[model samples]
Target: MSVLRINVILFGIGNIGSALINQVLESQQFFREKRNIDLRFPIITNSTLAFFEKEGVKNAWEANFDQLAIPFTIEGIIEFAQNKGLENVIAVDATASSELVKHYIPLIQNGFNIVAVNQNANVLHIDFYKEIRRNLKKFDKTFLYETNIEAGIPVLKLISDLYYSGEKITKIRGVFSDSLSYVFNRFSSEDVPFSKILNDAEKRGLLKKDFRDELSGVEVAKKLLVLARELGKNTEFLDIKISSLFYDDLEGTNLKSKFYFDADILDKYLEIAKITQVKNEVLRYVGEISIADEKLEVKLISEPITSAIGQLKGSETVFEIYTESHGNVPIIVHGDSSRKKTTTIARGILTDILKVAEKIKIKETVWL
Candidate 1:
């Protein structure tokens, strides 16, 4: 049996990216011996610097990347892959940069499979999204973005599977952001103020560098748009009506230093919580999309503790799927949504990489 060598070109060396590298290295021998495949990373990069080795980067490449990696552009990296005539290449995008995402189509044009952890590229305009799918079909390439919707859970795959099986998805609803989940879950269970809970989540590195991205409900809206678009709804980000948990003017304020200074700003949530408590309900930030009505929304709602959305604990994300087959009962997909530690998200990326590899192997066998 001949071993297949799948070259990986990774973008971003942050938590998830670094964890993916270590994971690939850790599983290198196991995959080689058992699966008859060699997973090799020829390029690893951050925002400013990149490490490249045509012969495949060794385990100690991190030290070399730190000491000798050079500056690189998107074009430069693609040209290097072109010059090397790399085959069975998989482009792994772990960055959140919109600029990096712009290179996805070009990468596909060059015969590279894609596994993206970032959601920005997938939630583009409907035309661009269609173009991406068209390009993937035109080039005979695979693009897997299982980690985009929720970090670890296979929500996208579940939807795709259901759709392919002729099950019509009538409505998709869930809590998308684990950061907001932790905030609201704690706010309801504990006696802490909403502002204090938000501060604690920031301190725990649950929120993004820009705290507004999480609290503003924009990120959850993007996830909902991606899900809606995947369900064959021709919807864009603007289509989703997001009811943010924070005040509108909180964007320009110095949230980093004065996060706890303005406790009264979060009083609205506390007031709602108190009212909900009286009604025997819990507060949760929920994302919902009605496929039949062509509606999408992400908002904070109050529900009984026994409800699917209210039973969530910590930063776990829960997706309730309503289909023609399962009307009142929903197919629930629930798990931790926190990407700070990188275990689940990294595993999701690795699963995508392996899936691509398996496809390549099957194609090779068919060719033989």
Candidate 2:
């Protein structure tokens, strides 16, 4: 029997990666039999090294790590992918690093499809985003990052599909940052120290140690930029007005720092919400895009709310998309909602892509 094959390159092997790898292995037969697709994770990488197997990586690639060896580096990964004649390759950036973004431009330009869980690349300078998009257009490759904002949420896919289907979106808003939502909701009732909460969360693997990306609202802003781009608007990161709750000194620092929020700030906000009789009110960091009379407004809304934002449990994300056709669509997508979730999302996106490709191929063959 002839086998259908799809090549996969993975950039991280942490918790999410492990979960994803397990899922892929468990679902391998289902994919082949049900979807008529055979997916293979040929390359697994980390910051320092990578493991490549042309015969297809075993599900236990990391086991007995001493004997099975491969040098891990960005250059090595790129070289291996090119050498393997791996067309329609799926690059999973589970590393959550901005450095991987540069590799994407070249990969996309070379006809590689990428499914990333990394939000850093999308949040970078507008020029970088544009360059990647241009390369994607030039090579006709797919760059799927639906996991960036909300894992397994289909947020980006929904937005892109709606826009392409001629549906007009008037506003975009939701609980964008799981970390911030977690922290705020946890401390809404008490005068807990921000530093302590960050430490506890990180130690528990609930939040990234580098909390700036989540606290500075840059992550939320980046997701908004992606949505805007999908909506046919030319937007940059700076275009979004983020009302960051943390001070500038907190920027780029790990969560282990001794930074604490002003008790007064927390107290005042809490008191106001209480006096206003808002039940379950908690501070939620939001980025919004609204269109009124053909004029678009893109800004961040830092408000105390009683909705999903304030009520987000654990690391789940709930977002709402309002369109002319769909009206109000509420999407609730959950995962580890940590670094682990990001990696899983990347894997899920890759699996989804292979399934989609299989369907397309089947349709084309039938038509022919």
Candidate 3:
């Protein structure tokens, strides 16, 4: 049997990273036997500690890494991969650190195909984002980041696929954030205080610990910006007008804890919720981009229960893509409200990895 070997250099050994490493180890043999691909994790790391084994680490790498891994730098990792002379080298990033994203261009230039869940790189300055794409083409390397948005719902891939398939995309809209979805869904359906629901979400890890990270609407805005660029719209972060879920009346009283001191902010949400209730609708944090109108906005709006977005339950995310061929009934991709799970995100990263592997074919045929 011939072995098609591929080396993996993974960064970020947090929940998502650890899950990916585990999945790789568990499925290594299956992939080898079924697909003729030998996946190797030569380097696995977090921000400070890392474990390096050229033959791939043992199945129980976590216990061993704690004792064995030494201090290493990104430069060292790059040098090691280069010296190995492997044909397929994939760098998988699960970290949110922008510092690591700074090395993406260089990594691609060094013949390392990248698969990342980090959104920072994809939503970088328009110029830099374009530059990275240019490098990937120039070096004949691949950069797949289908997990960058909405926990690997393949939303970005859906856009690109339709765009390249001769479909004229006119509008893209969706409920984009899990945290926001959970917060608003519960707040709308239940009579619980908005502050209580917000607190519950934060404690349950549904919302960012800082709270404003989701309440400020920046996350949804960033996601919209990423999609806008993909749709060939010339726009930047500032170009999108955002409607914050938090009220402006409480601008200075530490909004993170405002729910405790300022109950009036909750009143604002209640007023909107009651109004929507009378209208027989649900509140959803929605992001929209209209190519024809040249508009991009992220806001907390109410949609009728009959609508695809309004019928969403729990933390589910729904994307409605309007293309010329699809007409008024847009193509929808739905996430099962469980995108925050580490395993799901890791699975998305693995999907991208295999996509890169498919490019490696029989360079030379040999008879046994």
Best by TM-score: 1
By lDDT, the candidates rank as 1, 3, 2
Cα RMSDs, all models: 2.0, 4.2, 2.7
Residue pairs that clash (backbone atoms under 3 angstroms), model 1: none
Best by lDDT: 1
* lDDT tens per residue, model 3, 1-368: 57788888899999999898888889999999998889888888989888877354455778767867889888888888778766689989899999999999989888899999998987778888999989998998888888878665788888998887788999999898877778777877787777788778878888776766577788889889888888777688989999887677655547766656786666666666656564678888899998889999998777887888888888888899998777899998887665457888998899899988877543324221
Clashes of each: 0, 2, 0
lDDT of each: 0.84, 0.66, 0.82
Give the better candidate number (1 or 2) by lDDT: 1
Preferred candidate (TM-score higher): 1 or 3:
1
Deviation (Å) of 311 in candidate 1: 1.0
Question: How do all models score by TM-score?
Answer: 0.94, 0.79, 0.92
Tell me which of candidates 1 and 2 scores higher on TM-score: 1
Give the runs in model 1 whose Cα sits over 4 Å from its true position.
54-59, 249-261, 276-278, 337-340
Worst 10 residues of 1 by lDDT: 250-259
**lDDT at position 139, candidate 2:** 72
